[model samples]
Target chain A: MPVRLYLSHVGKSFTMHLQGGTTIPVVSGVDFSVGEGECVVLGGPSGAGKSSILKMIYGNYRCDQGQILVTVGDEIVNVADSEPRKILQLRKDVIGYVSQFLRVIPRVPAVEVVAEPLILQGADEGKALARARDLLTRLNVPERLWGLPPATFSGGEQQRVNIARGFIAHYPLLLLDEPTASLDAANRAVVVELVAEKKQDGVAMVGILHDQDVRDRISDRIVDVTAFRAEAA
Target chain B: MTDFFSDDPLLQVNGVTRYYGDRIGCRNVSFQLWPGEVLAIVGESGSGKTTLLNCLSTRLAPTAGAIEYRMRDGAMRNLYQLGEAERRLLMRTDWGFVHQNAADGLRMTVSAGANVGERLMAVGDRHYGHIRETATDWLGRVEIEADRIDDDPRSFSGGMRQRLQIARNLVTHPRLVFMDEPTGGLDVSVQARLLDLLRRLVADLGLSVVIVTHDLAVARLLSHRIMVMRHGEVIETGLTDQVLDDPREPYTQLLVSSILQV
Candidate 1:
């Protein structure tokens, strides 16, 4: 299978500019290649920088060294050091991210939050809203909460909204951070089924999931992140 | 025919033809729909799929031909041959038709709950509380907010309205359903998700569906069997997988391979 994401000798460090430019290193010499239709999970305890690895791939955090190449259509992009505009473009076109938190403008409804990705990509507003409603419903988020923003929603409800927003786009490389964390068992099963469907559609996924059952069921392989803990400078 | 019943086919459509003045809408179509089977009738615009669907579902009278429906009593009754009241009863209880536009199928001014419960009320379910409860349950089943059951369907968006229409039709547990481009106007993602929901409902309810759509993808996703129609005539008929994977007819192959520009 053709490789969709290739991370070679990746290294990241946080430099405190005020503290004599000292560097706190995380994720040094990390190498992995995720093929199309494969899901490589980041597995480790807290503070192991799994989220940072995702951020690096998403171009939210800069890598100090090595290549974070991603293929979109026929183009291979080095996401680690891509231009800011190109990174933004990639976020819109090639990469989809679902974090553990729900972040939306205050007073914006859940439907719009989930629909924004498609709307931003020049899809019709009515069509986008319809698709968003379907995703939110499938995630088991009550219909009453759809018109309400996540600010007033419960933790599980917000998480489901977050999840619905994430899977609304068709991205080749999807980065999921604890997708089913706050969901109930039934809703979690819904997400599991959705992930299985996406896998069958051949989307390359990288996820950080604490739930062992979902993690084992979805991942093609586990990338241990215990060695990537950001140490004190 | 006795052959259809012995094999348990739910509906037999034979030699169905329709004419709109000098223009022929459709001509000489025949097929059998079995229980739990989804049969998609695919054709280009004005290719007579809608006309055929209308004829089979009793929305329009065919100029010449007969549609035989297997009644709940396990008897073969010609749909067009039935009395007005009997046809209406069959439409209400035995079959469902999902329109492309939800507005045509729904009561615009009434609450979504009322729209869903209207069928139950028509079928002589008198208890107000049971009807309301059932409406709420159906709304939940279609992923509508139970709280919004009191709100009118006009207040909802297109996808929500389409889903509500589906709930209203399916809540009565109709043995057969006729869908006219159920996901036509929706976005790609919306279409995908709605297809998933429809697949789930069909499986759960053991529904027999005769859906008319120009979209080959829709046919591929839902239909057990597919009958390709063109120029108001049946061109090819086979299992959906076989027909889609290896189409024998040139017209069908072109239709299948034609890129969906939508």
Candidate 2:
């Protein structure tokens, strides 16, 4: 197995216009790599830029310096430099992100939110929805709520939906930012099992997590975002 | 739960029917809502989810059946039992709304603080200093900076504007809130933060909410129960996890499958 996602000397800074255009640097000169079937955990205190690094990898935030590269099959793409269409295509197939919350189209059912990806990839809608149900069930989302929209769901329930949506697609690379932040201990265990299964399937993952147990269970290596935090400071 | 009126539902909707000219808006819709509960309505466009919501909110008159709501005084009365003026006042005092567009829910010309304080004012708060202080506190809770208090919502970003709108509607501490795709158009990052905030506020306040959205994730995070509608009728209704995990209905199965994953 080779490196699926690579980062070297990554840096990011925020221009706070409110603070009289003060440029506040957060991450600087961070380096890491995630290989096939490997899980690299970014562990550190809050505000240490663990999420910023993950954001840079997912192309949500731009890195000021260094390479944030991802290998989609054999082609290596710099997430920071990719075009919008290229990033979207990569997002659709290669790289997946499970952020803290579940963002979705209103009035859609829980099953459709999870199953829609497969349907777009040409899978039968019925089959896709059924598979979505399987994931939701495994994650412990209520059976009755499948038909309802999720706007009224609990924080923990919402996070499960985000997890289901992220895991529904088979990607070469995955990013998890406190994926279990809102989950209780019981649900957290389910996510741990899911991550293990994903690892066995050869999907490489990089996650920013504070839960020491989950981090210990999933990490093949630990990248201390504190290292970058120190540099930025 | 008290055995006396223990089964007394907070809202009892029976055989409600709504029509749009010759078109059926929704037919024979019936459900019960409890205190401190959230209910989500889900369906594709023209599936009658919107029509069903309109009827429940009394935005549209139902052609048949009855909708009963339990007032704060614990009296169950038919919706039309009250005068038109009383119904309008009840909507203002007891219910809150968060629309798909922040502009629709907020006074864009007003300051962010004023937008939140207006709800308090509506309920008869006259102390200018107290209202301002409370407004500032809510702004902080919603992750809005104090500096933005004097700024108008029209100049704010989409996420900020939406947050301001939520603060406004919540100021009066309404028991029931009606939201139509509250996080529909925001970016994923923004939407996540908003959902977390909403969950906290709802729990802290013990609010009952009737929300209509197409997104299953929102329902799962915020509601205890869910109702699935298709073509103006509820095809399935159950506990959030149960319905999503083990859908018994065919239409529900398609809906579960219809979600587009990121």
Candidate 3:
């Protein structure tokens, strides 16, 4: 399989400017790659920088040193050093990320929230909403709740909505951050099926899944995050 | 949709800085706004977001730096270098500024039809029948009753007046619009309604918007990218979701975390 995402010697550390510039190193020398149709799980304990690695890959967090390359239609763009505009363009056209929580514009209905990714991609509004409704149905989100904002939904329902939104668009690379954290058994199974579908579509996925059953079922490889943990001086 | 002009930015601001005597209004702010993109300037009170907005809209002169806008004729002209008449024409035909107060943007004493029709007149529309018909159509589009077209803005509710202001500005089909706290002082439900309307209209019009607001929710709803101002300087700028979800700057992180999650 072709590599869709590759990270070489990626590192991250936070500086506490308010605390007299105290530096806290999070992760260092991180290296991983996800191939098309492959799902790689970042496995480690809490605070092991799994989420940080994911954010770095998504361009939400800037890496200190290294190349985070994403293949876009024959061109390989490095996320670590790309301009903000380029990162935004890459996000719109290439990457899809589902964080642990669903953060959306207040009062935007759940269906619109799910449809927004596709709409941003310039898909027709009617078809985008139809696809959103289909995803919501597949995720077991109540039909009535589709018209309501996900903010009012239960934790599990909101996660499902988030999942639907993330999966609504066709992105070459998808990042899943605790996607099934709040899901029930049935919903979790649905997420597993969604992962299988993405794999069938030849998407490259990197996820931080704590649910061992879901992780074991979906992960083609487990990258131990603790090996990249930066030691405190 | 062609490759030639599609990649050209609609507006470009290079190192725009403004000062109120010894104090900084905004310092060295710069960004490019592409067509059909909405960029939000966000910060706490007194962060110079409004000052930046005013400078971008040509309402206030900057102490330094230049703003260049791509005209309908496809020539990039420095806003400061334009003749007064040309600037006024651009304001009337290609640009719109929606103030925080509807009264500031509207003629409160005039009937809503006149308020909307006045913009048409500014752009050389003279036929009374056509102007009134267009005004009535706009009122319907903004969710105001067609019969309310004859009512003056002062007689309308705050939200209605604001919507009227929007209709008046959009009547000429301006390609670029600058909004300053467009939903600042409305009830939550009312704000939601207005936001929904604004979002739809912006998308439909393919407008390039520069919106200044302290409300992060408003910024999130209306903007594609966000520039966070602090102490008269842009502390952080990025795609809206990336900045809001995982802010890199400490101040930005504080601002994002401080929002009451009710």
Best by DockQ: 3
Q: Which stretches of candidate 1 lie over 4 Å from their true place?
A: A1-233, B1-6, B260-262
Q: What DockQ, between 0 and 1, does each candidate earn? A: 0.01, 0.02, 0.36
Tens-digit lDDT track for model 3 on A80-142? 998666777788879999875887566789999999889888899999999999999999988
Give me the candidate number with maximum lDDT: 3
| Candidate 1 chain A lDDT trough over 10 residues, lowest sum | A14-23
**Candidate 2 residue spans exceeding 4 A from truth:** A1-233, B1-6
Report the TM-score of candidate 1, chain A only.
Answer: 0.93
Cα lDDT tens digits, model 1, B89-204, are 88887788899999999999999999999999889999999999999998988888889999999899889999999999997899899999999999876776678679768866
RMSD in angstroms between candidate 1 and the native structure over all alpha carbons: 18.3
Candidate 1 chain B, run of 10 with poorest lDDT = B1-10
lDDT of the candidates, in the order given: 0.84, 0.82, 0.90
Using Cα atoms with residue i matched to residue i, what is each candidate's TM-score against the true structure? 0.53, 0.54, 0.93
lDDT of 1: 0.84
